[model samples]
Target chain A: DVKVTQSSRYLVKRTGEKVFLECVQDMDHENMFWYRQDPGLGLRLIYFSYDVKMKEKGDIPEGYSVSREKKERFSLILESASTNQTSMYLCASTVAGQGAWTPLHFGNGTRLTVT
Target chain B: DQQVKQNSPSLSVQEGRISILNCDYTNSMFDYFLWYKKYPAEGPTFLISISSIKDKNEDGRFTVFLNKSAKHLSLHIVPSQPGDSAVYFCAARGLNAGNMLTFGGGTRLMVKP
Candidate 1:
């Protein structure tokens, strides 16, 4: 079984503070993703890394960035956390497999609250 | 533009009844579709998937039906259990798109005992 673990289940930060969310996967998947879930908005991609040191901006990457220094770890960084940035963040990994189809294994998610 | 759409925001079903969740996509290039279940405070978990070539795929009590012509798909859960209550998200991936997925807004399923 594949396991994806997030650094925190809940977090609280003041406005303009820097925040980091960490994720680690045991499957050594090549693709890692960060997403934020909001009511009525679904899960919007924030950033994704296809390989170590390679990152791409997803649909909503503003005010957020990601790091993939190693194959097993991915981190999401908020430059300046704002109240609007409060959300449930999810990390997922997908193994490179046949035919462009790979099931994403996801972590439990971190709910961040900015005050 | 929202490529994937789930029109219904929520659905309620009696225990042991069938629960159907629908999803539509505007992108015709998507060849892979998936269903994920998410509980509060948890990330979405992969449930089942179907390829564009096949119209139907089933696993246990979950069945996914796809209509290529309409660019739509549906998930049917037989004998819905209370544990099935959660937000269900539909995701799609285009050919050669790697593992990136476009997801629907999701529909909350509530099962009554």
Candidate 2:
């Protein structure tokens, strides 16, 4: 029973404002990911962290960044929120390995609304 | 370009009937496939998975079937229940690539009594 928790389930922000979304996992998985889900677009990866302080850009990383200061916590930062940025964000974690077939444990997700 | 595609936007089925959700992928490199179920306002939960080495994987009432040559896969739920009503997403990952996954747009399943 792995638990992945997101800091906020819902959030509202004005345009041009910076926003932070946090995620924490109890399983101590080495790989954490941030994804934005939009209607018709499915889940597109924004950023991922393989280890503390190590981050990689995913398919849709523009206008977004991530932080992994600790093993258990990963944060997604919206540099400047815009109306188009409004969407559901998901965080997931999994163990580190080559032959690992572990399924990602996901948080409930944060729905952010930018007005 | 959409690498993975779930053609059906929605499907309706009656309780005690079988519900089939189909998904297709364009990438031949994809070696692993997965199915996830998501309720409204909740993140997608892992349902079942199948590797390229095998064509079918079953778990409880859910079964995943993969067709490598056609680059297609499907999820079948037997005796579908109301609780099975949700959005289902099909995902794929390449063997050599990192664990990053490419997901289909998803199909919504509605089970009615």
TM-score of each: 0.97, 0.98
Candidate 2 lDDT over A10-79, as tens digits, reads 9999999999999999988999999988877789889998899999999999999999999999999999
Error of 1 at B76 (Å): 0.6
Scored by DockQ, the top model is 2
Q: Ten consecutive residues with minimal summed lDDT in candidate 2 chain B?
A: B93-102
Best by lDDT: 1
Q: Model 2's lDDT to the true fold? A: 0.92
CAPRI-style docking class of model 2 based on DockQ: medium
True contacts kept of each: 0.59, 0.48
Candidate 2 chain A, run of 10 with poorest lDDT? A96-105
Over 4 Å off in model 2, which ranges?
A: none
Pairs clashing in candidate 2? none
Which 10 consecutive residues of model 1 chain A have the lowest summed lDDT?
A: A95-104
